[model samples]
Target chain A: MAERVLVKGTEAIGEAAIRAGCRLFFGYPITPQNELPEYMSKRMPEVGGTFLQTESEVATINMVYGAACTGTRVMTSTSSPGFSLMQEGISYMACAQLPAVLVNVVRGGPGLGDIQPSQGDYWQATKGGGHGDYKLIVLAPSTVQEAVDLTVLAFDLADKYRTPVVIIADGVIGQMMEPVTFPEFRNLNTLPKHDDWALTGANGREKHIVVSFDIDPHVLEKMNLEIVEKLRKIEANEKRWEEYKLEDAEIVITAFGTVGRIAKSVVEQARKEGIKAGLFRPITLWPFPYERLEEISKGKKLILDVEMNMGQMLEDVKLAVKDHARIEFYGRMGGVVPTPDEIFEALKKFLNV
Target chain B: MLMGQILSLAGMFEGKHVTWMPSYGPEMRGGTANCTVVVSDEEVASPVTSQAEVIVAMNIPSLLKFEKAVTPGGYLFINQSVVDREPTRIDINIVKVPCNDIADALGNLKVANMVMLGAVVEKTKVVSLDSIFMALEKKLTGGKASLIEVNKEAIKKGMEAAK
Candidate 1:
């Protein structure tokens, strides 16, 4: 049986990471997520784990890279501006195929915009915040409970795919308190073995090197192709989403993260008003869940895309619908949240309820 | 209903849709702030309550900031001891009560929110007291078990005052 307790989002992430067998954490304190490192600092030593409050995000990401290379489960976290600083390291981790978990409790930004919650980084996360042909399996959690749940899932997926995973939550979800149940930490022996590719001194087998290099043009192309194939498989197998009232929805709202939660409440309220509004929330953002959206939009009157950013994910919605359904967008920028009333008004216009 | 964000869960007003869209701005740092909770029987698309039907301002700043945002025929419940304001809007009903003073009498300052919540419920009767109590219990459990009694008492006081 699970016991419920009020948990802050940042602390939940730290606790979940520890329970997931993550032994190393390197992070910098940034607003909206300061509690994560602080929690880790107070708790990691007690569990015989290493928690380092690094000098900067750049240093922190590199520390994650080093720890991950040593075959240790490791993680780090930051907000928007700090996330920007860590991009180069993230890109390197992606290219090197390093499996690590990265948490971005996103705050407003475009250049130190503010320390408030914002989803403006949608494109940055989905389109590879760092660079190159890479993708960070982004999970946008709408609540403190999901924040913990997603952090645990992030480590598992990161290890399985040998890629960095990002848990993108806004300040609202990061700082809020909610009752949540954490699964008991499992024995390390039950987890999948990573000895196949993890660097463990080769253990008298053979010499091993951890690098993202291939001087030969054909070899590099082959490596790139292999990565693409893996991503394609992930897209095919890991597209998880939640559908509410979509089977007969006239106006469907596509949202992720906090906006999705507000959209959900609006759907219920709209239903009482006799408008068939539904919510389609993506659990795995990187995979995009386009196919399911395409299937749901077959007979819908309109698809409303709600986000915290101005219009980052709006493009994806339009692309998925492809003129098959009338599409519109609603959003807030710089950490301002979209209210259910505002969303309801928008839905009424589209559905004519 | 189980999207699991503590602030977005079921409210005291059963059959009413209520959501809290938290301000990610300066108010988040213990500064005076407000959230829009819409208690609607019909479906609501937008959750932002720019102009509230009723507002309970616990501090001077909350009063100053939200005074203009009340609907033309809405009500503004103020703790007279905490906020002193000349009635400027004739269309809106303004009820001034010494809520902070009552909370002081109740032996806790934090019950101010519960008191205001009670007054809002009694004046508007939008949400049921039992439901609010349930939500409050969920919200204030764990390290806060000691204050629940005082908060429950404060809510009772506000309900009686409103009646």
Candidate 2:
């Protein structure tokens, strides 16, 4: 058995990426997620990988784009504002069908907000952030161990679908240290070959061109249709979620990322007080587990959506439950992490207990 | 921060779930820096807690800030060497340790955190002393390895004092 070691979440994600056969990392320094690039810088050299601190987030994303075109595993990580800067690059990569892993250790948003944990980027990550019609497969992890697991999975998903995959974690998951046992390093020689679409030197064969745009409107429409088809396949297969103490639950709490795990504690607390509360955490934000949530909310009295932002995922929860369950929202905006006590109080007030 | 880290590591070594979350940014540079450590037998849900099972206050500001955060029957270990005030809360168990004085007696003032950690471990049994020693040996490597004996001694003195 692999020995368990205590590791910070940022460093763990870097190690996981390396183990997943990702060799190239390009990112700019950002608050709350600077440790990720720092870890990459030190470990990349040891593993014969390349780690480059680009001049800006814009440059970082484009560097990822260029490296990914060669079919090599590439990744970049940043926080809220830095992620905002990479949206255009992300759209171009999605349209070009380039595979790359992106991590956003989200902090307070809407500009240069405080360097504290927040889930304000839910809409940006799930819905399209950049211009055009493209969707990035988004994975949200609640625990440090889950963060490590999802990072490795992000690379695989990115490569499998020929699209960029994002691991959206909050500052709490980025800064926290936890005990984790990592999987064995993937042999770089054994990784999947992407020779079909990779921009390897055309060795006296038909040249393969990778471009996101075409002057002909009809050709562009055809390319967009292909992307839409790919997204539909992903949506069908990639939906993921978790249910905790939901079998006998009357009031179900729906959350994602950091808020999800925090609400788990609230579930235990509410259960201790005979409140019959449960937790539903969506692990995949883009291909959201809407059907599973709808199935679970069938007999539940209420579905409470909790978040670090002002009711972003609540829209999806409302859509899933529809009129089957009464919906309520409890959120703490601008980087404030709601405590279990506070969330329990809200639940009690809702039940008038 | 080191104390909380060592405790979390020791818990991991004991095959328990543990998480350590530190307060980052400018507040960690010169201001009141703090970290939260949660050790549990089951999977830890939240890394942050409004009420802690135990709180080690190294100074007066921390005691004043977190004294009320202790659960009714929780343990509150205060560093008497720096904190001049007494905790007004009568619901929790308070173990006052002169961490700086003990470390000074051990020929270094840097092991004061370990001294307070010793008191918490002896009182709470959160992790075994053997595990703490192992974690300390693992953490204090290279140039920092030579100070392990003194730190161990400070911890032993803290345990004896807590008794």
Candidate 3:
């Protein structure tokens, strides 16, 4: 087994990206996620990578688009408001089929609400904040170790599907510290070649053009249809979730990211008190584990949906269960995290035990 | 924040699951800067807890703010040098240690946090002192390397005072 090291979440993500052979990064500074770019700025040079602190988030996302067009592993990270600024570029990336990793260490916000952690951007990330009929593969990680693992996976998925991927983490995951074991560093020389589509001077062959715009409506519709096909395949293959103590669970809890892990404690406490409770945590918010959730929720007495926002993910939970089970929502908005005790209390009240 | 980080590293060295989360933003800027560290045999779930098994209150405001947060029969290490009043909680075990005074005796008041850490470790036995020394060596590197000896001495004094 690899030796474990104590590291902050943001730094762990940066290190994981480097180990995954990502050599280019472009980002703007934002609260909560500032450590990520700061870590990249220091580590990128050491690893012979480029880390550019762009003038703004708009500039940052465009830079990512440009770098990604070269078929290089590239990424940008920001907080909620800055993430909002990158929407137009993200839409363009989605349309152009560019491979890039975008991280949003989300904070409390409709607009710069606070620098504390929040999950208010769930709809924006999984449901496409950017304009257009498109989708970005969204991965939400609960722990620092998972954050590292998913960062590497994000690069792979982005390259595999030739589409942008978003790592939707909260401020708590961005700032927290945990022990993590990193994967072996990838050799840049052995990375998959992308010379087929990459614009590498064309050299006696046809010149490749990458653009999101087209004049004809019919042609654009065809392009949109192709994207839809790709999204369907991704949705079929990429849905990921975790089930804990679900075999005999009378009550099921659905949560993601930071709230998901916290709900695990509630499940443990509930079981200790003779309540048959379980936790179903969605790891992929975009390709939501709707089918598995529907399958597991059967015969469960109550389904509790917990989050750090005003019940954003509850909508998806409702969609998954779909009248099959009783669903309840417990949420705290504007960066207030719900504790395990309160969640257990809520669970006991619902169970009346 | 530093003490919380050290405890996390020590826990890791001891082959336990650990997480360290500090209060950020306004709470860290001249306010009662506090952190939560959870070390467990099983995978840790929440990084933040409403009730904690142990809490080291470094100042009066921190003590007053987190007094009720400690679980019943849990350890609450109070920095008695600065905090003039006694805690109101009766269920929790309170170990009042003069962290600042001990660090002052060790000729470096900045090691006050380390002193409090020693007291906590001595009382709770969460992590070994050797693991703490190892963590300190890793954390206090480069320009801060020279102060490790004084910090270790402060931790020893804190352990003795707790006894």
Candidate 4:
């Protein structure tokens, strides 16, 4: 293992992005995620990278969109409300096929709410936040270490697909500190250059126009169909989830992000009590892994969806399980995270224990 | 902000896996601000946790808020200078120390958290005093270079009081 350092998730993710060869960052201050840009502000200049805090979230996203069109591994971070401000820019990036990382360290409520962790942005993240039929490659990391790893993956996945990637994490994961050993510093030296589409002064090559607006109806439909096809391929290959003791479990618990981490403890307690409870953690929130859930659902008595929001991801769990087993949901919202005891009580009610 | 960092460093320096979360509560200072640290032998799952085996409450609200969350037979080290409410839980052990007094005696009330930290290290034996001292030296020098000695003295006073 590499050398372990105790770091907050915000600090770790920023350093991981630096190691992942992301140099240019544009961000606006938002609660629960401000430390991220703080880290970048200190580290980016040291590494000859650009870290600019724009006047507003709208400016940050548009600046990121402009930087990303130049094939720069760029990023912008915000909480729910700030992310809402970036929706138009996000849609433009999706249309322009720009590779950039966006992090939504979600806080509570539908408006300017509390700075506590909440998973209410599930719909905004997974279901095209902007005004378009587009999807972002969203990865939900549970722990601080996973935040680092998934951030590295998010950048790579974004570049590989030539689209934006979202690291949809809650405030808990964003603010938490943990021992993390980053992978050997993958410097920008070893990465592939995106010179083909990159606007590098043409360099004696043909001119490139990075445009999201093609007025022809047929051409726009083709672009939308192409995005649909990419998402289809992604859904097929990138559905990632973890199953714990699903073989003998009669009740399967489904959760993601912080709720999933808390559910692991509940699963451990339920197992010790011989309750035959298991856990399924969705790592990729956008792909919404269901193939394994389908296999686990065959013999399970029930699927309990635990979320910090009120049954946001539960709809997907039902769509995946699809009448094979009864689906139940228990959630705590508005920044009130449930404890293991609370989850266990919910489990008992669902499992009739 | 640095409480969880020092604890996690001490834990990692002891060759253990540790995870922590610091509350950036909107209240900011003097308003129930605290952090949670979990040190274990193996990789810890999830940063979201409810219970603590040992809670070092430096303020009254923290003591009141986190006292019940401590496990049965767990330790609750409170700064008796600010917190006077006797913990209602009988199963847990409470070590109420005059943290502000000791830090003030040592000539720096700002090291009150360090005092409580030293007490936690001595009582829980979760991390060595040497590790914490090393962490303090690093943390102290990284920012305010002048308060290092008084904080160390505060920790020494705390170690003595913890006994």
Candidate 5:
């Protein structure tokens, strides 16, 4: 049974990772996401797990790579800048097909922006910021409980696909406290079946090799094709979103993560004023559920894309809706979140309501 | 922050959806140190709220900053020991409770958050006083339970002084 408790997003993700059988965590401390590593540092030892704080984000992601290759469920947490440092490692892990869960509790960016929340990393997360041709199963959670649930889900998805999964959240989800019930504790004995590829010491069998590099161009192309196929399978099977009051709505608001939650409030406000406004919140940011959005846009009057950055997800929304519907945008940057009232006012002006 | 937890816990105790967003900066007091606790029947979308139905100001600056945000017919709980002036808004209901004085009289000034919490609960009935105590019992960890009695007294004084 899931026990309900008031939880901060960072703490919830940490505890959920532990419950999800994450036995190894290697992460450096960074603002907005420090609680995650701190929680792991305290709790991992209690559960006979390993929690290591490396010297830098580079070291941390590399450590996660090593631990995960050994068939251990490993994770790391960081903010925008720290995540940037780990991007190369992320790409390497993707090519290596290592299953590890990573979290970027996004803060203001471009530089060492403030510790406050911002969704500016949307493009980085969804568009494969690392390098090469690979994708991370990106999940954006709006609520603390969803953070816990998605953190657990991230591990399952990573292990199933033999790829990395990123729980992309913002500072609001990291810093805020809300009542959360964690998913049921998963036993460590029921861990993912990675024995065939895992680099456990060769006992009674041939030594296992976990390598990302291949000299033969055609062989490397085959490996790349395999990873691309996995992404396609994930995309087809794991598209998740939530639709609110879309049945008779004239206008729809599309958003994800923190801005998504605020946009829901705007939808509610618009409805209260007798406007037919609906909300479409994407739970799985990548494997971007464009098909459902296309179906929803069929007869809609307008689709407003509300995001934290000036407009990162705006391009994707436009691509989804195309000329099927007129797409508009409203966003705030640099850790300054747009309020529900502000968003509603913008909606009113945009729709002339 | 303590009061934020208490009220949110009380809301959860009442089966309401509760979310608290706290601000942390360099300065502790007299700075723009405040938090937003959204208690609603529906699933809350955003934790940040520009307008509040209630304002619980523990100090002068909080009152000065949050007073205008209160809705026309909402509630305002002011810690009179710290705030020397009346609210400028005429539309909202104001409950003046000297939380600092109440907690000091009960022997622990730190429980001022609890006192203000009690007044907010009493004035708005946002949660039961029993729920507040229950939340405190679970929260006031080892060695801290010893002070629960004084905090309870402070809450009672807050309830009485709110009107």
Candidate 6:
């Protein structure tokens, strides 16, 4: 039966993780995402789960590293600044090929930006937030419901690939209240077997030292090549994006995360006004659906890149369309949202219809 | 605000294509606070509702802030005690109920949400009382059982008062 209740987005992530069988959560409090750890504290105990509000973002990421090493489904959340502080651990986790979920409930800025929603992290998330040659699976969910669903899928995908996964959202999606449903527990299950690559004492086997250090340049290149090959396999298997009204579209808008949701509304309103504008929302930011975008933009004249920052994703759109379409950009920076009417206006300017 | 509340509320829909535009910040604490929940059977690319077809104005700020966003032929429900603003929009249907009074009479201020829920139930009829009750039971328990009963009473009183 269909049910409706109002809930904030951060709490939804915590609840979904618990239902997805995540047993451990370690996070430091940051604006917008603080609700996630707060929710975990109240409910994780009920499920006999572990929820710890660590001293710092660094400690939290290390905690995630520890739990993930034990093969436990674990997660941590932080805003942009804290996420930046966590980049080192995230890089280490990526190098170790740990299965864990990290949520970046993004806020404004290149540094200590205000606690307002912003998508400036687009490049950081998709281009590997940390150094070295590694990629983390990134999922962008625009609504409270998707926050729940995506967090669940993040764990599954992380385990399936044995790589870290990121739930990249903005403060707007994190703070909003919407109706969401938890699927029946039967459909979700956490794996009980992860000791092969994990560090559960090596179980009387050779001591497993998980590190990214090999003193040989040739070995480093081989490791990088192996990681690239794995990423290619993931791209082929998991690239996902949603298309709306593209078959007959004259102008297509590409957006992700919170801005994508607003762009969707603008597309619908534009259509009502007899404009042939469509929406392409990327659910998976990394392993981007470039092929699908290329195929869909075949007959389009213009592709509008909409984001919360100053056109970070526009570069990707240009690369995908390969100049087949004239690309335009519209963005609101420092946590401002482009409303449907604003997006519609942009569409009119782009298509001139 | 609670985990169960966030989970059960998010569970009502089944899709990634919904918009959840929430107007929240430090400015919301002192004044009235509200959010937009857009549930489309089809894919929703953006989820910001400036005006609401139905305004569950728990306080006056919610009513004044969102009442103008209502579509021409929409409905507005305000809790009489908390909302002191006069109705300015003549096109939308206005349903006023003493929800706070009802919740107060029921002996709990927290039940105000339930009272608003009852008012929403009557106007939108989006979900049945039994289902909402089930959600409540699933959301609240143990020491919270008393709260559930009070909230249920508030719902009943608001529904009857609306009638």
lDDT of each: 0.78, 0.92, 0.91, 0.85, 0.89, 0.79
lDDT of each residue in A176-211, candidate 3, tens digit only? 999999999999998766888876778999998888
lDDT of 5 by residue, A167-254 (tens): 9998899989999988777988898769899998999999998988899999999999999999999999999998988999899999
The local lDDT score (0 to 100) that residue A284 gets in candidate 4 is 94
Better of 1 and 2 by DockQ: 2
Runs of candidate 2 exceeding 4 Å displacement: none
What is candidate 3's local distance difference test score?
0.91
- Clashes per prediction? 18, 0, 0, 0, 0, 15
Q: What would the per-residue lDDT of candidate 4 be over residues B14-114, giving only the tens digit for each residue? A: 88888777777665656667777888897676555678888888777787788888988999898899987787888998898899988888767788887
Per-residue lDDT, model 3, residue A232, is: 97
TM-score, cand. 1 vs. native? 0.83
Candidate 4: DockQ? 0.67
- Residues A97-164, candidate 2, lDDT per residue (tens digit)? 99999999999877899889999999999899999999999999988888889999999999899999
* lDDT tens digits by residue: candidate 1, A24-78: 8898888878888999999999988888888998899999988778667899988
Model 1: lDDT of residue A352 = 61
**What TM-score does each of the candidates earn?**
0.83, 0.99, 0.98, 0.96, 0.97, 0.84
Which residue pairs come into collision in candidate 5?
none
**Strongest candidate by lDDT:** 2
Best by DockQ: 3
Error of 1 at B69 (Å): 6.1
Better of 1 and 4 by lDDT: 4
Q: Please, what are the lDDT tens digits per residue for candidate 6 over residues A1-353?
A: 64444577898898888878887899898887888989889988998888888999999899888888877899999899999999999898888778899999989897777888899988888888788889889999977788889988998899888789999998888887666777544233437557666677856898776666678999878877877888989999998787877878888989998888788778788888887888999899998888889888887878889988998888788888886778889998988777888878777876766
- The regions of model 6 sitting more than 4 angstroms off are A1-8, A19-21, A46-48, A143-145, A176-196, B1-22, B25-31, B39-45, B56-60, B78-87, B94-140, B147-163
Model 2 in CAPRI terms: which quality? Answer: high
Cα misplacement distance, residue B41 of candidate 4 (Å):
2.4
Q: What lDDT score is found at residue A262 in candidate 2? A: 90
For each prediction, how big is the interface RMSD?
Answer: 5.0, 0.5, 0.7, 1.7, 1.1, 3.6
Which has the higher lDDT value, candidate number 3 or candidate number 4? 3
